[model samples]
Target: MSTILTYHYVGDAPADAGSHKSLFVPKHEFESQLRAIKKMGLETVSPEEFHAGLLAKDLKRKVWLTFDDGRLDNYELAFPLLKEAGLKATFFIIADHSLGCEPGYITVPMMKEMLAAGMSIGSHTLTHPHLARIPAEQLAREVAASKQQLEDALGVAVTSFCYPYGNFNAAVQEEVRAAGYLLATATIRDNRNCDADRWQLRRAMVTPGKSRSRFRYMFSSLYHWLHEWKNRKRWKPREEA
Candidate 1:
């Protein structure tokens, strides 16, 4: 099985980040988590390798590192550490945020630099709207236009899509597929076993203030088993008296 981990901001969350400040993972903590992944013998896969692994069902001891929202801190803080660790990650860009109109998010130049350093890019929608609640026309534009914008700007064929805020439904997913994306990731937390759906591929979010031990547990088969069990129990039907 393969694990997909999600991250957002790196280092301290700036005051402008507002309520989303809780998403910040300190640089030290992030570095320790990366080291723990290495210590546990989990190898980070490139986007192409992850896609191929999903198709072949050959993922074992593999992990895919992903960062969402195209934050500049990701470029300033996380990029160096990843390079130093000899690792690669996919940064899901909010296409509109990279157009220089946004203040805190990454720009197209920064993304290109990271890509040149062996990182990958994916689409995170045009405006990061709630995909499940949007109208059909808006949903279609959010999925298809973002891919076109990112690819046009980055000069690469973007094939992966990440649901903004992990909000997606069947219609939203179909729009993504119809847009020609190969895979999509959701907010669900679990390892990608052979039977895992590529459209809703599970990802465990790496939040702030997580301990080294806790981070280690995130990669454990036992943790995944317990997580799955809890989810099943939560949704399971109550027995009749």
Candidate 2:
């Protein structure tokens, strides 16, 4: 089982300190975490690797470092830090909001530059809306349209999807799978997919507030066990059927 490390803003670009979704990691702290990722020997893997691993039952040990919303801070802050570390990551972009070829969350030049610099781009959705309860047509639009948007913008095949807010059900997953996505990541869900449930891969939320010891613990399975036991909050059960 691979632990996918999920992150948000890195540079705190919106510049507001109190935003919860942002979770702005300052440049220095972000660099520290990047160093930690490198020092820990967690080889970064793309979603394509996860998909191929599911098919071949290969477990060579890798971490999928992913960022959601395609935020400006990701391009400004995270990109440089990862570059310095000689690493790369996947960004899931909400497509409809992209104006002038890039959304306010991220700019056009940033996307162009990142692709030019060898980064993988994925689709979040066309509008970043709640998918589980939306109409079928709308859901299809969100799935297919956003992918088309990404491929057109980046000039590469966009095959991964990350659920917005981690909200997705069986039908939603089916929609995304049929829409040509190879892998889909869900928030707050964790497990190694054994071919049957590869679409909804789980991720671990690594926050700036977590201590270095806790960070180290995350590289092991014990981290999830201890976190769940300590909190007593039932995990959204792994897809075992």
Candidate 3:
């Protein structure tokens, strides 16, 4: 079994950011979390590797680190830590939010630097809309167009899709598949076992503040068991493989 962790931002709050700043973690905390994860021997894999591992049932002690929205903090803060740790991760980027258009979003150069450093990139949709609430046509456009845009911009195949707000249904899942995405991730906090669905892969959200012990226990077998037990009834199992 393997756990996939989700992060939004990793930097100090801006003065004007207000309550929206809750999504960020201080740079030190982020580094500490990565160190704790690495100390536990949880290897981080790209989305493609994760998919292959799931199919081969060879994901023991492996974990996938994912960041949502193409934030500059990912390039400035997290990328160096990951490189220093000898780890790789998939960044789910909003194509529209990238480059010089959006303030605080990473530019194309930064993305290229990350790719050169061995990081993978994925699509977080064109505008980051809620996939479940949108119309079918709009949903298809969001899923398909974003992949095309990211591939065009980054000059690499963007095979992963992350559901904005973790809102997706069967139809949304199929839309992602039809969009040519090899994997899709949701905010379900549990280890993805052998029976994991490639399109609806689950992930645990990383809060800003947590002790090293809590971070260590996150990858513990007992913690995963407790998480499964608590969320089992609330989460429907994936379709049989």
Candidate 4:
């Protein structure tokens, strides 16, 4: 069994919470979470490692640590903590927003340092736009441009993604696939996937809450059912209207 842990801001931000809304995970809390993972004995692997060997059907449970958006805080807050724990994470950055955002943004130099220090980088599209709502060509442009920018800056293969706003349809998934992404994390909760969902992977949303529900969820599939029901309902009402 495997679990993907999703995160956003690793450090404090303006309370406004723009860009990635619930993606924010405070620094101290993140450390606490990582410590918990270690203390609990779950082997945390990179997405690539899971692909390689961690996902064997009989393999013990594992986790993947993922961060979204290219915030300066990732470099400032998350990096040191990850280093102290000797753990690595995959950071899905909005390549175009790598710099020149508000008070601060991640620069190529910062990205370079992380890469050198063993962190993996993935794309979150060019402008962080909703790929599902845009025109066909615009969607293609966003995917291609982000992949290119990250490749040029990081000088490594940028292969994974997490859909912006946690909203993507089949067309959007295929577009990202055609653009060369090997894996993508959706905002869906509770369901752990098999090999068929390798490209469109499942990541449990790690909010300020839900960290301690492990034993509860383990005992009850109904807990997972209720969570999925609510999240799916979160999207269905607009269509009915």
TM-score per candidate, chains pooled: 0.92, 0.86, 0.91, 0.83
Full-model lDDT for every candidate: 0.85, 0.75, 0.83, 0.72
Q: Rank the candidates by TM-score, best first.
A: 1, 3, 2, 4
* Candidate 2 structure quality by residue, lDDT tens digits, 127-195: 888888799899999999888877877678888999897778788898988988998888763433457
In model 1, what are the clashing residue pairs, if there are any?
none
Total clashes for model 3: 0
Please give the lDDT score at residue 84 for candidate 3.
Answer: 94
| Residue runs of model 2 more than 4 Å from their true location after superposition | 12-22, 99-103, 189-194, 226-241
> Compared with the true structure, what per-residue lDDT tens digits does model 4 show for residues 71-119?
7788899888987887888888887678444445678888788878778
RMSD of each: 3.5, 3.2, 2.9, 3.5
Candidate ranking under lDDT, highest first, comes to 1, 3, 2, 4
Better of 1 and 2 by lDDT: 1
Question: After aligning candidate 3 to the native by TM-score, how far in Å is the CA of 185 from where it should be?
Answer: 0.4
Please give the lDDT score for candidate 3.
0.83
User: What global local distance difference test value does model 1 have?
Assistant: 0.85
- lDDT (tens digit, per residue) of candidate 3 on 125-239: 8898978889999999989988997788889899999989877888999899888889998877776555447877877777767788777766778877888887776666532
Total backbone collisions, model 4: 1
Q: What is the Å distance of residue 38 in model 4 from its true position?
A: 0.7
